[model samples]
Target: MSTGTERSPAVVGKLSTLDRFLPVWIGVAMVVGLLLGRTIPGVNDALSAVSVDGISLPIAIGLLVMMYPVLAKVRYDRLDSVTGDKRLLAASLALNWVLGPALMFTLAWLLLPDLPEYRTGLIIVGLARCIAMVVIWNDLACGDREAAAVLVAVNSVFQVVMFSVLGWFYLSVLPGWLGLEQTTIEASPWLIAKSVVIFLGVPLVAGFASRYFGERAKGRQWYEEKFVPGISPWALYGLLFTIVVLFALQGDRITSQPLDVVRIALPLLVYFAVMWGGGYALGAAIGLGYERTTTLAFTAAGNNFELAIAVSIATYGATSGQALAGVVGPLIEVPVLVGLVYVSLALRSRFAATPPKSIVHHD
Candidate 1:
């Protein structure tokens, strides 16, 4: 909603072609992963065998690499002003923690009650929330960059504490209470914590440290223009690599239950559309400025599929229905978010925007 200023085509063109076609890459990753899983003899087993405890070492490495760049982009210094807008911040939190998950829970049950593993995966996707790519979506929508960064930082910290508890309660306990099938899935908070520590916490610390020291040593321009752009693609590569590994591990299952991906996708599609509209209406109703509203809308709508995928693989085997469901999340999300980007752009002129100079600036 925030028309910060009409950015030049040159500025918009700076967004890499790969970023524009993220969904295509995701689809390609799925096919490639399936191919590798089916064709390569012993490859899946070989990767699966390389584990520390229940966590796959290769997948863990992939997740860490995928997460760090996204986390590193957060301007932690900008966070001092996040609390300055308490109403908008409170609404953002409520959307992510309450309405977001509640909607997914109800939809997952209503749509996929017969498929518990896939249901659990959808629930996991909902709880993880967006910490990474929402920044990209927000930026594309001309949202307040600082608000987006601060909200992302807040969500990252909140997710570290809450994801496991919520994942456990919703996936394991809530279902049983509702008389849904008792799933064998172990949504252990510790397991979730360990995954969070490795995937989210490490990257968060590294991102902040990188920003603090790099800015002091080299200056903000060099860090943002040179360093940030350089590391950005690594996140995408890491994601594709992890996806390949996940699907390869689950080749047998994927081959057998091809329609299950479609099944997992249905609820996610609804979540994105409904949550985006809901967040936008809530923001407009609460008298939020366009930039903040755009930030809130994208942040609420985007799912941290990276974290969801990691947790799914950790909690359930890579080949389990849950892991497959997790992969389907990004497959659904990338294109959906891309479409929302256009929607936001089209609606920009209709909404009045406050100057975001006091809030944040874009690179």
Candidate 2:
């Protein structure tokens, strides 16, 4: 018999109707993008040509719009409270940075040795840890929202520094060790750095500035209640637009061999399941409460596909197999993670009977 912790009403964030039908929206976007790409001649070429030093200018702007609102919600002031639970922090970090990448590398090599571009793409997806969507998932699971927010903030900062170095190493160096001589990406760490700065840096700065100034001027409640909510929807709009643009550019490739998406999705599904299960077990072993356990699990399972897609297109051209793989990441991830939400709810009853911990202390 399994004991369970009671669910707290405060822990759940009521998802909007749009949030509930997110999968349908994304799927429609994919189809519409494909239609535009096929029917409107020169559409893809026009979008692709709007580039600066190999980075697509339009996509960069779209990504910045997509990422900024999420970053703005991060309460940098609350970061100090995270230290009270160092074990959970350490475990979550290990799963995200260390084990996550290694597992991706192993799976990519094992499943896609013959398909190197797809393999590189999968590795890229694994490296870009969750920032935005995990919050929704954490909320739905009744997880520790403050901890999730802190981890998201930390990951955002960490990604800008680490993505380039790791991208170069995993995509350029590690493939050769496995005796895959032909699998080489000429992409430089500088390119990844440049993309991260363009997509992530600008928004990160904007988000911090907005939060810092707005909070001081209008009071915390106004900033939190009004300012944050006002900008949040923009992120989703940007995401949908980015998806359309991605599919518009890659329509030909996708239409030719649609099975390629399925191929890419295989490893991703395994990665999500493994990461969620591992993070949950680790949290349990460390004696974390139900809310914290769900936070760690959802965070571990989620991928920042926005960053992944942008980096893929920037590193390899939009039409490349790698870019298609990146697109597939979100297409599969959204629905899968949605299903995991219910799983988390169901499994809530199986957790040890510890009283749920309140949110961390902060200003």
Candidate 3:
């Protein structure tokens, strides 16, 4: 964990408050979404109309804002350290792309063969690695923030490039083992690039620029204290609203096919346990400290549901198997990650008696 002895009191105070309330607010937002979904029928469609240049405005803006803190905290110097830790990186990559997908596929086949409606849901959940939420998890776990930041940047870049390729491979080439029919997946590259620009590029650029300017003008203390806290809630609320809209769009299908949730949950739970455990063990075997281990574990375990959700809706329609799978990811992700945070804390003592030195630097 980053020691704050050198940090300005005001910045520390701001972060402390945000760290405390963000999760609670996120939980409440979820419940609110469920209630709204059940009580108000056309609410999602109404909200969906808030779009920019054909993209859903709330989701696009939420995605951009949510990434701000993530990019803001990243340490570019970590790129040098990445090469030094080749073993950890290779292990994470193999597990995330290879074993992770295979295990999810097997679990989905075993759990949901009878329910074809949710088969795509399983694949989407399995293939999408964590993008935004992992930053929060890494922060909470006192993980190597620099490494986590670098990994997230790398993953975000890779996700855009590999989404179509992996989506096709999973849907067509890998479906044979489950006796599933090959489904055609189509996405306009232009639209995807646009989404990536609005959701990821804008926030990333804005965050970097803000951090740079703040450091030069008011200082890092002022930026961290005043600006970050103010934006945090809005970003989180945007994410919650996005989730509500996503689930609301699928409310009718979910209400009708209640069993689909169960079907999607099984593989997801299995995938989470397997990936988290595998990453934890692998990190330990490589003799990494607790912070690095936690970072590696989450980097492997987390899924990028935003891109998955967008692609699912675009390629498979809102009510299709793909979109349902994307929706099921967060329902499983939130609580599971919270539990893992505790687990990480418990394992912290085993790795190092003191906090890792890597996390001590503020910048």
lDDT of 1 by residue, 134-215 (tens): 7667865767766876787688777878886776677668778988765544455665556556655677788789988999
Per-candidate TM equals: 0.79, 0.76, 0.83
lDDT of 3 by residue, 1-363 (tens): 233232245544646454546567667766676667667967777767787655677666666656676567655445467546787677777877787777776787788777665776677666666766777677666677677766766666666676677768887887765567766567556655665566556766776787787778997678766765555455445556666665665555566666777778778888888899999999888877677788889989988776677777877787677787777788778778868876886676677542344553432
List the candidate 1 regions with Cα displacement exceeding 4 Å. 1-26, 51-53, 57-59, 132-145, 160-185, 229-252, 304-319, 357-359
RMSD of each: 3.9, 5.2, 4.2
On the 0 to 100 scale, the lDDT of residue 337 in model 2 is 80
Highest lDDT, which number?
1
Clashing pairs in 1: none
* Candidate 2 minimal-lDDT segment of 10 residues: 1-10
Q: How close is candidate 3 to the true structure, as a TM-score?
A: 0.83
Clashes of 3: 5
- The residue-by-residue lDDT of candidate 2 on 1-363, one tens digit each, is 011234344332344555556667768887888887888899989998998886667777777777777667767676566657898789888999888888988898788878888988898888888876676567546676567866776676667677766766777677666666434444445655565566556776887899899998999899877887777677667767876886787676667777887788889899889999999899888988677888899989888776677777766876777878887787677668868876887787777664434342211
Instruction: Pick the winner on lDDT between candidates 1 and 2.
Output: 1
